[model samples]
Target: MKGQENKEEKMECKKEENLVSCLCTYYSCSRKGVCCDCIRYHLKSRQLPGCCFSRDAEATYDRSFEHFARLVQEGKV
Candidate 1:
């Protein structure tokens, strides 16, 4: 039980640290500061996380590989 509690505490600390550097613009996502969860969720949907996109591109909410390609071509990614 103590070990589990310690693990939970460590996770919380990491989350707090991650929040400081996370650039995801979504305000209500449960995985906002949790990179692993966000990546897994997006990958399952054949998309990438918001942080992978540029500010303007990310604002469009089009996280598809196709969009990324466009951004890359436009030198925005």
Candidate 2:
């Protein structure tokens, strides 16, 4: 029972921990701390998550694959 409780506690802590490091500037995003949901939603729209880009790049809100490619070419990513 103690081990099971610890497992559940860790699961809840994971999301809280993720929220701390999440670089997404979209303050109202529902998927902000949920990596799986965020990845799925962005991929469906042919874009990557904000975490994939640098702080300056992420602030631009251009999450498109093409934008990422350009950043890579420019050695920004």
Candidate 3:
């Protein structure tokens, strides 16, 4: 129980830290600071999270794998 409590506390701390650096432009996102949840949600839609894209690309809101590949091929990533 103690270990579980510590783990939960650590996760909360990590979420706070992640929030500070989260580059997702969607301000109302519930999973903004929760990377795992964000990834899962995006994956379900056959897309990647905003954090996976460059600032400009992320702003476009096109988190498709193809878009990321194009950016990578163009040396923009």
Candidate 4:
């Protein structure tokens, strides 16, 4: 029981660390590290969050879900 709880806590901590690592940092947006906040910030402007794109696409600042979808459809993702 306690062992399982410890393992679960460890997993949760790792997940948080991974989220921090996945932050979209190429832009000056205030929603850099928080995924939900980032998504909301972009969606408010009719844009997609950076995690929706490939590294190349994200670097280009093309935060459009349509563009990301196109990339995936075209096998570029």
Q: Give the top-scoring candidate (lDDT).
A: 2
lDDT-better candidate, 2 vs 4: 2
Write down the TM-score for model 1.
0.75
For model 3, how does the per-residue alpha-carbon lDDT over 1-71 read when each residue is reduced to its tens digit?
A: 55455343334437888888787999999999899899999999989999888788999999999998999
Residues 1-77, candidate 1: write the lDDT tens digits. Answer: 55455343334437778888776788899998888899999999889998888777888888998899988998876
- Overall lDDT per candidate, in order of appearance: 0.83, 0.91, 0.87, 0.70
Worst 10 residues of 1 by lDDT: 4-13
Worst 10-residue lDDT window for candidate 4 reads: 6-15
Q: What is the C-alpha RMSD of each candidate to the true structure, in Å?
A: 5.3, 5.2, 4.3, 6.1
lDDT at 9, model 4: 38
Residue pairs with colliding backbones in model 2 are none
Model 2, span 1-77: residue lDDT tens: 55455343333436687888898999999998898889999999999999999989999999999999999999999
Candidate 4's C-alpha runs over 4 A off are: 1-20
* TM-score of candidate 2 against the unseen true structure: 0.80
Q: Quote each prediction's TM-score.
A: 0.75, 0.80, 0.80, 0.62
The digit string of per-residue lDDT tens for model 4 on 23-73 reads: 375655555666667767889888887777767788887877788778989
Clashes per model (N, Cα, C within 3 A) = 0, 0, 0, 0
